[model samples]
Target: MAACIVEPILSSGGVIDPPAGYFAALKRKCEERGMLLIVDEAQTGLCRTGSWYAFERDGIVPDILTLSKTLGAGLPLAAVITTAEIEQAAHDRGYLFFTTHVSDPLVAAVGVTVLDVLQRDGLDTRAAQAGSALRAGLLELQERHECVGDVRGRGLMQGIELVTDRATKQGADRLGSAVTARCFELGLHMNVVQLPGMGGIFRIAPPLTASDEEIRTGLDILDTAIAECVSAAV
Candidate 1:
C-alpha cells in the first residue's frame, strides 16, 4: 500500500522509456508520501541499459530492486535487493514467501559464478558496444519501414514498434506477426510482443557475447522481414 513498483523499461508492456528524471521524480514523490520505491529490473538490469543498473542513468536508487530474466546466465535464477531497514523489518515481522528451494545452494552458487563471469569478462561493456551497433541499425530500419512507428530501448535491449498509421501512431499487430514469421523463416528467430489491439512491439535483446557481425546479421534479417512484410501487404 505504501510502495510504488515499476519496470525501469517497459518490456512486454511496450518497451517504452520514460522521459529523463522519470524515476528520480517518482522516487521523490514516493519518499514524500513515506512510501517505498521499488524498481523491477526484470528486463533492463545487468548492463542492459549500458550500465550495471538502468536506474543509474536516472540517478535514483530504489529502496527495493528485483532482477531476473538474464540473471542466471540461462539458468532460472532471480534476485531481490532491498535496503537493510526494510529487510530487517520483514525479518522482525516474520514475513516470508513460502519456499523450499527458493534459494537452493546450488543455484545460489551458480548465480555467484554468473556474477563473477559478468564482472571478470566485462560483459557489461560488451553489451554497451554491441548495443550501439544494434541500435544504430534499428534506427536505420525505421527510416526504410513505414510501419516502424517507434524505435526505443538501451544497451543490449532494443525495441521497434510497428504501426499501420504513422500519423496517429497506431499499432500494426497483424503486420507485426507477419514480419515475425517472415524473420523466422529467413533464419533469424525473433519475438514480437502483441498487446492485444494496441499492436506489436518487437523486442531485440541480443546476448552480450554476440559479435558485431552477428548483431549486424540480425538487423539485416529484421530489415528483410519488414521489407517482405510490407511488400506482401501492398
Candidate 2:
C-alpha cells in the first residue's frame, strides 16, 4: 500500500472517534508494512478537538499530516506537513508542488491570523470546556429521549444517534430528518450524517470560539426541537 489515510475522528462517518491507543496501533501496523500514515485533520485539527491535533491523544505522529477547513478560518486554504526526510525524498524524486491558488497573499494572511487568534484566545482549551457542556447536554437528551440512542465524540465535535428503540439500536432515519428540520426551524442548524446506516447520526460541531451562553442556547434549542418532534410523532 502506498499510504494509510485516516481522519482522527471519522467526522463524515458518524463522527466516530476510535478508542484510545487505536491510532498508535495503526501507526505500528503502517510502519511494519513500510507505509506512511497520513492523518487528515480537516475537521479535528487546529483546536477543534481540544488539542492541536486529535491524533495527539494516541501519542503517535503521522508521517504525513494534512490540514484544512479550520486553517482557513472560513477562507479556502490548505497545508500538507511532513518531516524533512520525506519532503527531501519527494523533492529528489522530482515531485512538483503547483497550484493556482497556492501562496495567495490574502488567504495566507488569513490563515496566519486564524492561527494567531486560536492561540491568543486559547481556543483549544475553550473547545474542551465547551465540549464538556455539549456532551453533558447530549447525554441528558439521551436520558430523556428514548430515540437518542447514543452520544459520542470529543472536544467541540459531537454527534447524537437517533434510534427507533435504544435496545434494538435501529436507525430512526425519518425521525432524524424531522429533528434536523425542527432544529433548523428553531434557529439551530444541524448536520445529519447522509451515509447509509447512519442517517440518524447528527453532527454537532459548534465553533470553537462559541461562548458558553451560545452553547447553552444551542442546547436549549436542541432540547426543545427534539421534544417537539418526538412528541409530534407520538
Candidate 3:
C-alpha cells in the first residue's frame, strides 16, 4: 500500500509560494515511494488564493483534493475531486458511504448561486486584485510595527504573524489574541489562529463580496489594534 501524503498548507502563516521547488520535490518523492499526494484546500480553494486552487498557483496537481467552507456560500456542503482511477478504485473495493440527509436541495441551490456569482461578478479576478492590495498594505504595516514577524499569503486568504522577538521569531500568541478581541469589539470580525508548536497568526479573510473600501477599513482596524497591543505590552 502506498503511503498517503498530506501537505496542509506550506505554512499556517498564510498562502505562500510553497518554497521554491517544494511541490516538485514532493511530487518526485511521491512517485519514488508510490505515494498519493492529497491537498486540503478547505481554506485556499474557490478563488481564495488568487487562483481557483492554491495548488494551481504552484503548478502542481494533487492525486486527490478536498474542498468545503466557501463551496456552499456559507450553506453546508463539501466535495472531493479526484481522478477517474481513484473513483474506479473505490468502486472496485465495493465501498459505499452515504449520509441520509447529505443532499439538501436548499444548500444545492446556494452552491449553484455561488458558482454563478463567482463567474458573473469576477470574484476570482477581484480576489487577485484585492489580495495584492491587502498584502501590500500588510507589508507596510509590518514595517511600522516591529512586533510583526511576517506578513504572507495569497489572494484574500492572508495572515499576519506576530512575534515578541524578531531575532528569535518567537510567537506572541497572547498579543494575537488581544488584537483579535479588540477587532471584534471594534465591530470587525476576524480570526486569530494558533498553530500548535508554532507562532501565532492572525487571519484576514473577508467575504468575496467585500468592497475595496471595506477591505481597507478592516486592515485599518487591524493596524490600530496591533499598535494598541504593542503599546500596552511595552
Candidate 4:
C-alpha cells in the first residue's frame, strides 16, 4: 500500500486501543514501502486518550495527522497537520484547496483557546487520572456483571463490550441500548455501538472538565442500568 490510514484508537468501530508496539511496527512497514502513515486522531486527540495525541502512546509520528471533534472544544473545527517537507512539496506543486469553513477566524480562535485551556489546565494529566479511576470502576463492574465481557480503552475514552456469556464472548447487541436508555433515565447520557461481528459496545467519553464525583456518578448509573437489564432478562 502507498499509504495506510488508521485510527490511533478505533473509536467509531469500537473503543479498541491497539496492542503495544502495534503502531511502531506499522510505521516501520509503511516506511519500508515509502508510504505515508496517516493517523486519524480525530476522536482520540486533544487529551481524549490521556495524551495530546493518541499516536504518542505508540512512540511514533504519523506523516499526515488529522484532528477533529475535540479540536474546537465543542465547536465545528478540524485540522490536518503534516511535516514541513510535505507542506513545501504541496506548496511547490501549487496545491490550492479552500473552504469557507476552514478559513473562519472565529473557529480558529476557538481552536487556539481550546489548546490553551487544555495545556494550562493539564487536561492530559487529568484525563490519565480520571481514566485510571474509571477503568478501575469498570473492572469492578466486569467482575460483578457477567454481561460486561470486556472493558478496554485509555484516558477519558473507555468502553465496555456487552456479552451474554463471558466464556463464549457472545454479543449482546440490544443490551447496550437497554443500558443506555436506563442510564439516561437516571441522568447519565451514554453512547453505544452495534457493529458487525462486534455486537454492542458502550463508549464512556466524559468531558475533561468533569469532576471525580461526576465520573463516579456516571459509573454508578451505568452499573445500575446494566444490572437492571440483566436481572430483567433473568
- RMSD to the hidden true structure, all candidates: 1.2, 1.0, 2.2, 1.3
lDDT per residue for candidate 1 within 30-97, as digits (tens), equals: 98999999999988998777888999988999999999877888778899999898999999999979
Highest lDDT scorer = 2
How many clashing pairs does model 4 include?
Answer: 0
Q: Please, what are the lDDT tens digits per residue for candidate 3 over residues 79-168?
A: 778999988998999978789657778887887787788889888899999998898989999999998899877788788888988999
Sort order, lDDT high to low? 2, 4, 1, 3
Query: Which scores higher on lDDT, 2 or 4?
Result: 2
Candidate 4 residue-wise lDDT, 1-234, digit = tens? 768999988996889888989999999999999999999988898998888998998899999999988878878999999999999988999999888676799999999999999999999999999999999999999999988899999999999999988898888887877888888999998888756656469888999888999999989998899989888878
lDDT of each: 0.87, 0.93, 0.79, 0.90
Where is model 3 more than 4 Å wrong at Cα?
1-17, 195-199
Two-way TM-score contest, 1 vs 3, winner: 1
Residue 175 of candidate 3: its Cα lDDT?
87
Candidate 1 — worst ten consecutive residues by lDDT sum? 191-200
> Which portions of model 4 miss their true places by more than 4 Å?
194-199
* All candidates: TM-score: 0.96, 0.97, 0.90, 0.96
Q: Is candidate 1 or candidate 2 better by TM-score?
A: 2
